[model samples]
Every structure is written in structure tokens, then in C-alpha cells.
Target chain A: MGAILEIKHVSKFFGGLAANSDVSFELAEGMIMGLIGPNGAGKTTLFNCITGYYPPSRGEVIFKGRKMNGLEPNKVCKLGMARTWQKVRPLAKMSVLDNVMVGALCRTNSLKVARDIALEQLKVVRLDRKADFLAGGLPIGERKKLEVARVLATRPQLLLLDEVMGGLNPAESEEIIQLILDIKKHGITQMVIEHDMKAIMRISDRIVVLNSGEKLAEGSPEEIVANQAVVEAYLGSEH
Target chain B: MKTILNKLGNNRGFSPVAISLWIAALAGLALFPQFVDNPYALHVMILFFLSTIMGESWNILGGYTGQYSVGHAAYFGVGAYTTMMLMQYRQIPPWLGMWAGVAVVMVVALVIGSICFRLRGPYFVLASIAVAEIMRLCAVNLKDLTNGAEGILATEIPPFKIGATVVTDFLSKVPFYYIGLSFAVLTIVATMLVQHSKLGYYFQAIREDQDAAHALGISLSFHKNVALLLSAGFTSLAGSFYAIYVGFIDPPTVLALDISVQIVLICIIGGIGTIYGPVVGSLVLVPLSEALRSNLIAQGIFKLGLASEESGVGVFLKENLAHAHALIYGILVVVVILFMPDGVLGFARKLFTARNRGNA
Candidate 1:
């Protein structure tokens, strides 16, 4: 089959600066693609363009063979795609479990249905223990996990993880990598943005690199480490 | 279902406790006026029930969706003016005039809601205030249609005397009492129905987080307008009740800023969004207001020798505390907000939940 999601030559301009310039890629079914770059490589800008947070100044973002241009983030979500913010955005006063229940409301109007789904999703994210606790009391790692559980409760066909593991310890990072794989096992297509080269290499089936809002290279990790452009863009003179 | 419901706060559908309580309250209202036929007491009850209805209606949009609208008087004024004009000139019964009032308010609220739903948070609040002011001003300046500040008035048409327990004179306040009580109960039940229905959860979701709700495929504008229209329609009914209860209506001061703020204040005091918030709020605020008013003017510690009814120092307090009464209400609202943000009932619910959580 064709790719599950296709970003065809997308260029998102914020005034004169191209936050994402001519960024193009695709995620096939069952594929876990990694989008990585040095800080400010426009990796997130590309995700935003695809997810309809920012409509590309040039070119279309297609999901499951449908155009996603000029769509609001909510509409994009209804199309069975969901994303977490780079920063946590929990409803502060609500219980931790209720935060996840919000995603289920998208698909079901019944609080009972939403609650049941949110509960199971929380268990999957290992957040069931703290479900009754107010979300404000959660640590950053648990908060990130809560975000993932919230998306899972929405039953999204495509899941985008936006630096959810950014602040985790090494052990915490490995657990998240496994969680990503487990999520893929449930037949959801995945794209994760990460700065940790080791975690990205461990989970992603394919990798795309960006530099200064431009696509620098696209290859397997082994090939990417060998590429002169990738090394120069990220490693500089470290090696 | 119970497990999930507890996890997510109250459940939908008719909980047995709510149904039984409503039924019992209705029965009591049907008979209570028999014992107490006093007109002043009747007037107090009328205003109390009216505020309850308005609070309940506003809760549909404000409490459920977290859309804090301060200008609800726009809807109330439309209802009042619609009924007053139709009854005065067209000679329509308020029974029919009330529906006309309802339609006008709903259509206007829908249009405003559709446009205003786009603006989030503080912007939406500002837009709602602007719409309410514009509507009020239009009602004021349009002298040809609305009679400007010169309002409509009708002499009190007492209910034609009926059976023994209910006389046509003061004896028939019973029917009006029943009707007011019915509206109060109906508003509460209607709020409950929407709370448990599929739409209620959508409202809760939208309130909690709009973007997250939208991502789940919920239609933001559709549900909000539905809520706003429903809220407007019900509130206008209360306005119509106010006109008939008083036998007169005016544009400028009769249906003004104070009317709008009073409804919300009652909701806040009772606990906004919760089922009994309006009822609880009306129960507390209305009686307190009445107490303040009655006690300000007179100077005697009067006691009604009737059974358990202790007549208070109402007349003297009414004379002396008129200015202070308004200030007291304002101060009370501030205290409630600062000390009990969830509202009076909301705080109570928190206590209940905390205890339950601990026991678990």
C-alpha cells in the first residue's frame, strides 16, 4: 500500500524565515519513523505543518491519501491522527486520569465510555496507580507518559510523539522505547521526534534528518552516521 | 459503569436519589402554600424560584462548558420585552407571549454564540459582554419598537377564584406557587437530563480543553450554540415569569446588568455546573437578601406566635441597611470566590470526594 501519511515538499514560512523548507517524507503502515536533528532544525516545525497546526506555505500534507491543507488541529485529529505537545499541557486541576479521559471524548460522548477507555489506556502507560491524583502533582516523566496515554485513549490511527522522552533518565528512556514499540504492535503508525540519538536509533524503523529547516539526509542510522553532511551538520568537529 | 463514573465524577442518566428528591420537592410545593398564604412570603418565593431557573439555564453553557458569560441579561431583556409588547399591544396571553420571547432570545444567542465561539478564554468573555451591551442598548434606543425607557405595565390580574383551599383572591396564590415551583423543578431536571446525556460529556470535554476536545472529533461550534440557545430559551421563560408576577415590565432598569449578575452570582454560590448549584444558591442567597431587606427598616424584635415561625427584626433592619445590603451581597460574592472557588456546593462536593477517596 501507499504510505499512510505523506508530506509532499512542505515549506512553512514564518515571515522571511522558513521554519520547515521543502520538507518531504512518508510513513508506511506499521512503520515507526524517527524525525531527528540538532536543536532548532525545524523538526517540530515539520510535525506542526503535517498535523495542521501550521498549514504549509507551500505544498500539501496528505494523510491516508487525503489532503490535510488548511485543516485545524482538531479536524486533523478527527481524521484519526493525534499529537502531544513538546511541553506538557495537562488540565492542571483535573485528576490525572481525567486528563486522559479528554481524548476519549473526541470519539465517544459517553463519560462512561470515555472513562473506561481512559482507564485501560492509563494502565498501558503504567499510570493507573496515580489515576486519582491531581495532575498538578505529577512528576515530569509521569506527565509525559500521561500525554501518551491520553493519545492512546483517543484511539488514534496515527500517533505523533513530540519529544515526550526529552527529560527522562536513561532507564526511563528505555521504558519509553519499549512503550513506543508496544504502541506500534497495536497497529498504530508512529512518528517520534527526539534529540536522544540512542533512543531514536533503538526504536525508529527509518530516520529523517533536518538542518536549518532543510532536509540534510535520509538513511538508516548506520548509513547516517557515515554520511559527511549528517556528521558536519550535527557532530561538527567533535569527531 | 460505576467504576468509570466515579473515576470521572458524577454519572449520567437519572440517579435514584436525584429523582426521589425532585419528586418529593414537587409534592411539598404543591401543598406548602396552603399553610402559608402570605403575599410578601409569596413574592420572596417567586423571586427565589426565578433566580433558580436562570441559574440552572445559564449552567448549561457556563458551568458545563466553562464559558463564563456575565451578560446573560440580554436574553432576559429580550424575553421580558417580547412578552410585554405582545401582551400589551397584541393582546396575547403571556402563555403565548412567553414562547415569542423565547424564540427571539434563542435566535440572537445562537448568532452570538456561533461568532463568539471562535474567540477563546478572555476574548470570548469580552465578546459576550459586548453583545449583551449592544442588545441592551438597541432595546433602549429603539423607541419606536421598544418604547425606549417608558416600559409596559398591566394592573395585577388576580387568579379568578377557584375551589375551597384556593380562593380567587389571596386564596389562589397556590396555583401561581405551583407554577413557579414547577419551573424551578423543571429547570433542575432539564439540567440533569443534559448532564447525563451524550451531549453533557461533550460539554464537559469542551470545558476541560477545547483543542483536545476538537482533536477527538467533537464539533466545538455546534455544541456551544446548542448550549447557548438552550440557556437563552430557558432564561427568557424566567423573564416572562417576572413580568407576569409583577404585572409590569421595563427595558432600562427592569431587565438590566443587575439581573444578569444576580443569576450568575446565585450559580457561583450554589456551585456552577453541578445539578443543585442553582437551587442551593437560591436557597442561601435569596433568603439572606430577604432577611437583609426586611430587617433594615423596623426597630422591634417581633416574634410571630405561630408554631415554629419566629418573626425576625426585619422592619427596622430594612430601613437602616438598604445601602449596606447591596454592599454586603458584593462582599459575600468576593468571599465565596476567594475562600471557595468551586462555589458553595462545589466545595461541598470536594469534601465528599476527598472523604470517599480516603475511604477507598
Candidate 2:
């Protein structure tokens, strides 16, 4: 079977600096691939390039057997790709349910259908309790969960989760871990970028570690943690 | 009695409190002829309606989306001049000319919006201004067609008479007054529709975060462009009406930078991003300025007196009062941004939501 998303030798440069250089990876059907990198390893930049926030200076991104090069974000979404931001971008004045409804609006024009789907998404994230509250009023944990709910509302076939576990407590992390697992159970392909090793190791079927804009290693969870180079890179950064 | 009150409010097209206030204001406006039958008063009132419509037209784009444009007169001028010349050259009735103006302006707006809607924040605002100025210059220099700076005049006929009432006379202005008022209402209702629709949610999302809106596949360009079209259509209609009511068309009156800025000011003062604010702003600012000018000119017994040789001081005071409205508007904007941030309707909405929560 073909990979849901394939990034082959794609590089993006900002004037003199290469934000992403020869970065390549793929997500298979129903597979949760972990994209792990230190700050500025260009993980988010690579995501942006794939998602058409920035066009790659060279190379191609293939999504679902189509050349996904320089496609606008909305078109990319229409083609069954969705992403959650590292920072929650909920409409501050809108209720949490309404925030999700914006995403649902993409799938259905009917307000009732959108609202129903939004509520169901909120239920998946355990945010049904706060459905009527303003999104901006949510605490950090709830906001993070709300971002997940927002993406879910879009009903994407391939979900890109950016730092969904970045600043959560262990319990919140565990909750998201189960949510990711449940999402995979529903046959959605997932790619999560997280620094939380425990959560990543628990949920990711495969992990790709990036350092200095290059893919350092890609392997099973245990292999990534056991790789000599991965250990060296983490220790070298300490020095 | 409660049912009767609710029915009366529904008929009046607003809540009871708002309906009564509107009725009282209209009564005050009708009684103005007793105090001043002057053309100046009529002139000011006509300007009032134009500003009101421009401000309300702006509500769809600026107020709803929170994307500010300071160059709305581009559409207004397009509407006014396009229909004005159509009527002058072809002997087209101004009634038909108004619709033609609306169509022309909406097409132009769709094109402009398609190009410029991709830009956001201050970039969008700048593009709107530059485009409006370009059109202004084009209208001025398109000499053979536009009569260059010399403007086209509608061959005047008395107002469509109802049993011997020639109400269309610019001097009478009552008919013009009602026309402007209703157009303003139409703009408001159109805004209210956008606000209530799923389209409104898309606008709010795009305003708050563009990437998020796209992630949801709301198609920002398409929705924003529609908003700009709706806004342009009404603004152009007001412009065509201006040509008919003023019975003369000129570049400055239709396309000036001040005219664009005045709409923004009206929206800001009345309340930015609100359906009711523009109309309220117009109602408050427009007549007050007119009344102030006349009052300043007429010295009262033991009240404030103007002491200018050329009546320059009186004009200065009157103009200052207009400027003062802007000052009040600016301060009000700061206050709203700092305190209410949601705007007048936005604030009211919040209160309603909170009160509803308590009731529930």
C-alpha cells in the first residue's frame, strides 16, 4: 500500500539559511509516526512545507498518490489533510464548541450537522463539559485538548499533531496518548511531533529523530531510544 | 399587554426600547422643518445619510471580519459616478441607474476583493486605500466619458408626485431622508444576516487566525470576497442615491479621502464590529453637527456667543464639533479596545449570554 504522506528530499531555505534540508519521511496507513527533533531541527518547518505554508525550494511532497506541491492550505485540507497548531488558535471570543464547529463547517455547510460533529469531537477530547465556555477561557490542558478536538472536527484522513503534548502534566499526557490510540483505532493515519519521550514511545509505532535539519535516525520506538547516535546527539547537546 | 408590546416591537423591526427611541428620533427629524427650512439643513441631512450608509456598508467587511479598510469610497464613487453618467447620457431613470450602479460596483468590488483579500491586517487596509485613489484619479482624467473634473448632472424632474406633492425637490429633502434611512436599514439587515449565518463564523475564524480557518477549509478568499461584494453593492447603491438626491455628481463629494475616513470614523465611534453601531453613530453624530452649526450661528439670549469677524470662528467651532466627534470617536475606540474590546453589540452579546446563563 502507498504511504499516506511522502516527503522526498524536500528542502526549504529562508534566504541564506536552510530551514529544512533534504528532509524525507513517510506515514503509512494507520501508522503513528513520531517526528522528534530539538528546537530548530526544522520539524515544524518541514510540516509547514508539506502543508503548503511554505513551498519547498526543491523536491516534492506526495500525499495520497498526488503531487502535493505548493497547494494552498485550504486545498490541502480539502484533500483530507489537517493539522493542529503548537499554540491553540481557537477563536478567542467563540465558545469551545463553536471553535470546533469552524472546522466542521469545512465538511458540512449545515449548521446542525457541524454543531453535532463539533460536540462529538469535543466528547472525544473529554472537553464536552466545557463546550459552552469560550475557547480562550480554557486552561492550557483543555486548550491543548481543544486543538485536538478542532482537528478531529475536520474529519481528516491524515492528522498532523504539532506539540500536542508540549506542556501537559503526566495525566493530561496519558489522556492524549489514549486519544491518539483511539484515533488510530478509527483507521486515521497520525503523525505527532512531541518532545515527551514517554508519551511518544507509548503511542508512536515508528519514530524519526531529526538533528540540525537532517534526519538522524528513523526506526521502531526501542531502536530510536537505543541508537548510539541518538544517545550521542542528546549528550553532545548537553556539552 | 405583553403580547401587544412584543407584536408592536416586531412590527417596528427592533426591540421595544429601540423602536421607541427610533420613533422619537424620527419625530424630532420631522419637526426640523418648523425650525429650519433652509437648504443647508437639507444638505447636511443628505450628507448624514451618505455617511450612515457608507459606515453600514463598511460593517460587512470591516466590522464583521475585523479587517479594516479605509478606502471604501472606491465603491461609493464607482456607484455614484457610474450610475450618474448612465442617467445623464442615456436618459436612464435614476431608479434603474441605482441598480445598474450596484451591479457595476459589485463587479468591480469582486475583482478588487479577489486580488486584495489575500492580504490581511494593515496590508489589506493599504491596498484598499491605494485602489480607491487610483479609481478617483481615473474618474477625474477619463475626460471624454466622465466629463473629467466637471461631473455629470441629472436632468432634474420634480419628485414623483402623490396627488400634487413634488417631494423629490432637494430643497424639500423628506423623500430623500426616508430613502437614505431605509437604505441604511437594508445595509444593517444584510450585516445582521451575515452575522447570523455560518458565513459569519467563518469570518470570525479568519479574523482570529487565518491558518486555523484554512485548516477547517473555510476558504478564506471566497468568503472574504463575498463580504466585500455585499459591502460594495450597498455602498454603490447609496452613491447612486446620492447622485439622485443631490441631483448633481462631483468627484470630491463622491470619492474624496475624507469621505472614506468619515465612514471608518462613524463605524469606530458607533462601535466597530457591530451591526447597530454605525447607525447609532450616524444618528448621534450627523444631526448633532448640523444642529451645532445652526445653533452656533444663531446667538441665544445669554448663552454662548460666537465672536468671529468672517464667521470663521463660528465655522471653526462647527468644524471643531465635527472634529470633536472624531476625537470622541478616537477616545471611544481606545476605550472600547482597552475595556469593551468586543464592541457595543459584542459587549451587549456578552451580557446577554451571561444573563442567559444565569437564567438557565
Model 1 chain B: worst 10 consecutive residues (lDDT sum)? B300-309
lDDT of 2 by residue, B126-176 (tens): 999998998889889999888878888777633465568754554466667
Q: What is the C-alpha lDDT profile of model 1 across B271-339, one tens digit per residue?
A: 988988988899889988886676532323334422222334353344456657788888988999999
Q: Estimate the TM-score for candidate 2.
A: 0.85
Please provide, for model 2 over A1-239, each residue's C-alpha lDDT reduced to its tens digit, 9 standing for 90 to 100. 56999989998899989888888888798899999978888889888888887889998999999998989888888888999888778788788988999888888878789989999999999999999999989889999999989888888999999999888888998898999999999999999999888888989999999888889999999999889888777777454
lDDT of each: 0.81, 0.81
Query: What would you estimate as the lDDT of candidate 2?
Result: 0.81
Off by over 4 Å in 1: A92-101, A109-116, A129-137, A235-239, B1-20, B155-172, B296-320, B350-360
Error at B270, model 1, angstroms: 2.2
